[model samples]
Target: MRVTVSQPTRRGTRRSHGVRAPAPTVASMTRLLPVLATAAVLLAACTSDAETPASSGCDPALAAWADAGFSGAIAITAGGETVCEEGYGDANTALTVFAIGSVTKAFTAAAIYDLVDSGALVTSDRVGDLLPELRGPVRDATLMQLMTHTSGLNGSAGADHQPLWRADAIAAIGAMPLAFAPGTDHVYSNAAYTLLALVVEEVSDSTYREHAMTRILDGFASAGFWDGAPAAVGPRAVGHLDDGSTGEAGDFAGPHWALDGNGGLAMSMPDLAAWTHALFTGGVVSVESAAAIADPVVDLGDGAAETPGWVARDASAYGEPFLAAAGGGGDVGHDTMVVWIPSEERVVAVASNGGDVSAEELMAAVGPALAAGDPIPAPDAPGGTVDPDVAAAIVGDYRLDTGGAYRVSDDDGLRIAALGADAVEVLFPPRDAAAADAVRTHERAVADLLAGETPAGREELAALEDEFGPVGGAEPAGTIVADGELRTYATLATGDGPLLVWYALDDEGAVSAVEAGAQPPALDLVTDGDAFRPADPAGTGPDVTVSFAAGVLTVTGPDGAVTAQRD
Candidate 1:
């Protein structure tokens, strides 16, 4: 899928790219600001559990977070006992409420399953049965397809700039063509789940919030739909950007109700823990319904499977089987995750308001340690130098087969520039005046393509080469790959770090496919800022060695190395 620039909102909205904004007062904070002085004293006395040491089962996970300087709250349970409950960094209390983002889907999913258990609906029911207004192929989508994100709906249909009623949102969804045939493929769609929320309302004859409150949150905890107006909840944590920069208190804003069913849920760690406990223990739904909620009916192709609300996969730390669910939002500057090991009755929930670090990384670090029941050693820090000769071979201007060119320079470390109007518009979104105009021009071209004015979209894109000249700007910090194929990694000028540009060479050594923003997983390499180095100094990976031989420069890894011929 092509990557698109995402916009920010007052309420947390899920987006692929992080959105930077001046901090706004969150709903919870706004509601509690008047009572802050009094709440601080009462909260301090009530939060002693937040400092409790992890039981033997959770000690390693706690240690891992400590080692990584993680700023978050964590709660771990084993065999129905609390093994660890703690907070770190700015998230110094268990009562810190986090914008749980997509994790809200779990609650929404559970509500759907609850209705199923009550005989109000079934996974096999066609969505059209519930709402007759839905048009096109989407009407044929099963409840199961929506649960597993295979409903053929677009992941998102632009931004929800203002609050929208369920009917309005459904109408918008019905107007868009299906991205693909329903049930044929898995494409994550927040809109599909939002439709599920509408289904819940239609069957239960209750608002989505009312159904969720009574069925999912009532007995467990007081977490509710974030309506932008704070209810009487506990203290709220300030959200920080991914770079560890905190937004100002003045920036806390209200909820974006339009994101209902897909995201926009918030709660403290304890409440989150309670919610997890209820779902796994059949407290919220019957054992049979809970099982169905995590049945792994669809393969996600990444060694993971999708249940209604969770991703079933091998635990990264021990390769043990576990069900995991995660949610993150750049707009809210928060990430949250829950891991449930059914066999062991173990649950680990982590939530972070800081944007600089990902909850997934924190979970990955904690999972193995928790599973091992021992602290896993941290990977070695990155430090090494790329050979100048190897770097020189890959540094040059190469024209993209599609159109335009990119220049790689070794002048100040390695960097790449998106040259020409078309490439710049594709690689970078509208940020400044010239780039904004380019985007507008590109949008007009897209309108022409959509109108069938050109034989193909590619033709319109190629026509740009004649109409516009090159626009150049360099991204700092680049890595040259000399393994099997030549590739380079560099930070984009937009501040999103490390996009890989790959070059496929023909038999004559001419660059064949100049694909940009294609990155494979890192091989035994520890990344520190923009640089990479062998995770194990003594490891035998081919990437640990760089050599020049037979007119080729190679940066080798264990299985393979990227190589480029000397000019």
Candidate 2:
């Protein structure tokens, strides 16, 4: 059904990429968008005790996090009953309540659907038809597209210089060019929803935050959803930064801004689990939109090269690449996961203030590990030195600086980059060495895509990757090299074998690229950083350094480095 979504404006609203400033003092230093699918071993091995419908079970996955050094809260529900509710690490650095990010989107979408049910609006109506100020291609986009991210608006363009707040948000998105013809592709734009919040304000005749509090957040309190915003930091588990520091600098620390429709909602794990149950069960949107909302609307399979091995690998393992799902956006300092299993009549919410644990793998492991009635295995972290042959496979020239002119290359085991920084820093993490010894971050590029928990396009990419192979790793014997603009790369096999291939493109807002063990000539490339039409895309190798400490795996690349505990 079509609905009209209007964009609104706020007076004294300072905007930057749709986030209002006085940015909530949230201390978590999160990464972004690492989603999981079913094919991953984390799923196959974790779901051994698959209970029948209506059966409930304590998620053994809870204990798994402690093994992985995760600190936060978790809740599991079956048949609309609270099956498990428990807290792990601190909710805030002060040790108070849990802070929920972008889950606010689900609430916002629900509120919009409520308006539709009340005959106030329809999801199929054109956004521009509602608010004239929401001019340009956005006006041409429908409310459903905006809700589903099929509209080309981006929550945050990769521009670091863009100011972040309400006023700046409106101006930036309003002025930005459409990434694609509206409804032609899905980009997962938070700014689009922020604008939808504007629509909420326009129709409800109230502020976006006010409308949400009244229609959604308040519903939780009325429904026995406790664990409200903490007045003082309580005994919650604490999420720490890599440096082990807390307060404003750490992952879980302080309050930033209030929850709006687009983001900024905070609550305990049980509360969110309850809220999600209500949502999927028709407490908010109609069952029709509810089902449609969860259904896959766009394909994001090509974005895997930018995903970390932990996340990209999981998506390939869990749900089918064709299954539709949503709601997995996460920040670096902030780590949270909620998986609603319709067939099982279950909803599992896993949260943590900590950084760099494989939530998907943990879930996959827990489902089977618990089902097998297997005693929680002694914590055996994932670790194994890569064969020099495998290590030699990924070693080559890779582009480190995204927008820089100079190039970087790696020899045997050492990496040097002209990144044109103050000095030519050697970018590699040390194995069994001091943390300060590494030059560049070990897990940057790999972690960048996995930083957030957005689950929208994971299944699709996981399927494609499964058909291909790992983004990096040796096949038989070969050398990898950048072909043209460093947007694509090739791996030439030593014997009479085909060349491995990969490429990336910026469509709408998300990045898309495909890779295969065998190279394809008609690959697409991004030139001038804007247009990624079609060119022989190529890339220099990203210098990779791997280190293991205390059973943890640390990897460094161009963007940054993250260590995953092998629990």
Candidate 3:
């Protein structure tokens, strides 16, 4: 779960090959070992959620990012004023709202340049003559290759709140199969923005959320779309999760059809800082539809490119260049980001309805300390609180010295959070005792090693029948532990299909270590000093350390330390 959204948007800087690796499996080597498997990185398990009392124009780096626990809602603007609207914990940067995922594809690329400045639509319109029950090649893509995501359309026509409508999301993108051809290459289509909200409901006869709240957010006084059972009353915010709990709040202002016009908006933070100050100065759509919605030659490499509702980049961290976009916590817990900055005409915009900071990590922790007035760098303090009898003396079972076996118990935040419903990690200190086990015994030792029986401590395992051939049993999939080692999980059914595995038993329960294939693992963490170390989401982890004291526990890493005790 090494997630990353910014550090110059990390997808391995430029993947010509950098971040692909894996293939040699065993559930990708036990998810490359999350610090020996306590499997870290799943934060949102907050300790700070209610703020706003500081005053004197709050901003000591957003109160050291809500005293390090983190949470969101910010505003910022510049050219025309408003340099910093607040809200930190429970988020109220002026009344909440959130759910702005996929930053609604830069407002569906600014309503296709506000429907080509009212001439209705162009960009050489096509999608087979405006939605004619689309058939293949993403119905001959055009409207500038579905407004720059390069329209070979392949990212999905379903499952983003799949309630399905708009003729079953245009018959599921006219029955898939074209991840290529259309304007030749680029892919990130939410079914090409749900066919550009069904080409703005077939040329504005209306309803793609009423032509995006009256013509691409008409005057923008609180932006629109997102009804989720909303007749109106205001102060939204529900969201939370990442361990924090309560999720999805928008309910549906949505012309549904899988979030129409791609990832529906809910907005608010002074209407995303007045729609990034009316889409960079000259007002929303004109100078040739905002220069074809700001350049977009594609690239999307480290210098970034692809335009249409944002992502122009150029190495910011506040060193200039911007025009970004981000939306909710995948799996919907809510988060958003906007950023504009055309040479400081500025606009920052960050949103969250809980799951601690992540609106591009609170716009990279408050846009370069509010563009250098400086103060937001606080973060390190959370590596110690667990008293209630030292979390009942560090829960139970341990064993280690090396033979591996740990099963501590007590952190009742109930498992199930492998993350992404607004990811963040690092919430330690809730009276510890966090157990976590229910063995499928590595799916009955991968169904007795697919019936050929060789599962006794893996017996030099590794044949994967010529890299995976005939296979079909084993399923379970859970359990991890690490340093105080456990592993377990399952899946297999191979013939080149499902794979994913990870067995382990040692301390006499037998089996020892099994390994197998297919990608898996996505989670969170953070805290270092007396030794606690994983705060990921790219805050960087894996040096490993962990601690505990009197009853023992230890951990260390690079495969060296270990410890345990508590039996």
Candidate 4:
């Protein structure tokens, strides 16, 4: 049996095939004078025979970050006292606003819990009960299922490049077939959260943004919804791409309002720190609701737990209970992570503008130090080399279940083209003429380029630039081992920011899968003379193998064999 799974598209020009959300400093305040004075006296006494007294600030980890070329803001709070608060490079914690990406989900989830507390909604209520117009399997899903991404709904309704009315988007999502039976498995669905946001609007009789502003961010400083418009807010740090280019928050592609419930919040590091603090301290929601947000409701079976809005991991590293939420924009920019240690009443929030550093790395380096209130050593750099043989075998054509063919070319270091509608359309259906035209142009350009017609392809690419903006070329980034698979990363520069492409190979070293913009159909077999064998057979139908002849590919698995022709 051929099983099709819906994959969520990362918003922005660079799409990540893998699910990795991608990380700071400081301090001076008159209020700390008393503490500083006392510390100075104690330090002087201890160092009476020494030449200098120890500094009052106790964050060597933060100082180390500045030394490591970190270019963002960081805020750390412990026991209701501001432990470390500082900015690095171009970031200013007091003024520079950064897009928090999916971290917005936390605020949305908190709002839902608040509604439940107010007797306006319930976790058990079916989606159909709240939004009667939502049809199909999704209608039978409970709000809790939606919150935990177990709604069985498609991972995404589609991307939002064109202007899409929320009502119409909801209806379109309702029309999509469920990936599986509701509540049976785990699939991250931004569409589910978007629907939940609609539920919030219906229940509160206000827009999702409005509700969030009033209920979630009313008291926070310098935070607001990012509607994909140019930054009207000043002092905003532009997101940096892998190509060393910069663009305002809205410069990245994708629908802004459409990502509202799932992602779309922009704020400063201090504001995010404040929000997390308020969230866990019963300031935004009741203590019970807050606790529920951290409680793991779904076991991903990968040692990761999914809560309403946070991802929970083992507390062994922190030596206490820990919860973290992360968000990123497409591939190489605007990454943020917030970590909460409930037992210690500690919160660590980090935000970076470029992909050079990741929140996970920052947290890993700082978590131990923050927990111990002393700086620890920095962790090793992430990345490694791909097997030369594995890299050579991964060049070919792949058919996507969502209706497209991904062509991987080894001509000049692995370039790719989408034969039909690119994956972007699968998640974000074109709602306007411009979006539709762009999609067509992209398809045509890829086709021409794959055929080795550089001039014509470049012409089409130029047209795309005219429609969009300056498009950057793709370059090799690096490689890493994920889930026991060695995947290569490539960076694509766009008007918005840098996007990364992840290519996965099968056991036999064939290009078994490619995830960029949207999920492509997995490649199961590669031609070996006249015969073909399973490449990545795990989680597939059967172990049977077959042969290819007469320009047709025949695949036989346990269930049986099927024949398909090149498109």
The numbered model that scores best in lDDT is: 4
Q: Taking the tens digit of each residue's C-alpha lDDT, what string does model 4 give over 1-567?
A: 111113423232322111321100000000111111222222222222322212423344444555554678766666555655666666744357877777778888998998998999988899888887777778999988988878876434544333457777777788867767889976656678788888998899677777888887887767786555322254676676433455444554544445668766788876787788889889999999988888888875434577898777544432344666666643335667676667546666677775334443444334433334343455333222323454355455555454544444444233333333232232223334543453344334333332335533354346435544566675443332222123343444657565444443321112222334322223233333445342321211124444434434344543445544444
TM-scores of the candidates in the order shown: 0.60, 0.53, 0.34, 0.59
As a TM-score, model 1 comes out at 0.60
Candidate 4 Cα lDDT to native: 0.54
Q: Relative to the true structure, how large is the alpha-carbon lDDT of every model?
A: 0.52, 0.41, 0.52, 0.54
lDDT of 1 at 472: 24
Worst 10 residues of 4 by lDDT: 22-31
Instruction: Please rank every candidate by lDDT, starting with the best.
Output: 4, 1, 3, 2
Summarize candidate 3's per-residue lDDT along 1-567 as a digit string, tens digits. 121111111111100000000111221111111110010000100101222224423344455655454566666556756655677676745656666767787777787777778888887788778888777767877877776767776545654553667787788788766656877766555667778878877887776777777766777655675545322235766775433446555564343676667676776676777776777664766777776677756765545567775656554322445556665543356656565656546665667665434444434433343344444346544454444575566666555543444444445411112211011011111112222112233335444654556533242234554566655566554454331233544555767787665544322122333345422332233335555455433232334555678777665655456566666
For candidate 2, the TM-score is: 0.53
Q: Candidates 3 and 4: which is better by TM-score?
A: 4
lDDT value for model 1:
0.52
Best by TM-score: 1
RMSD of 4: 16.3
| The 10-residue segment with the lowest total lDDT in model 2 | 21-30
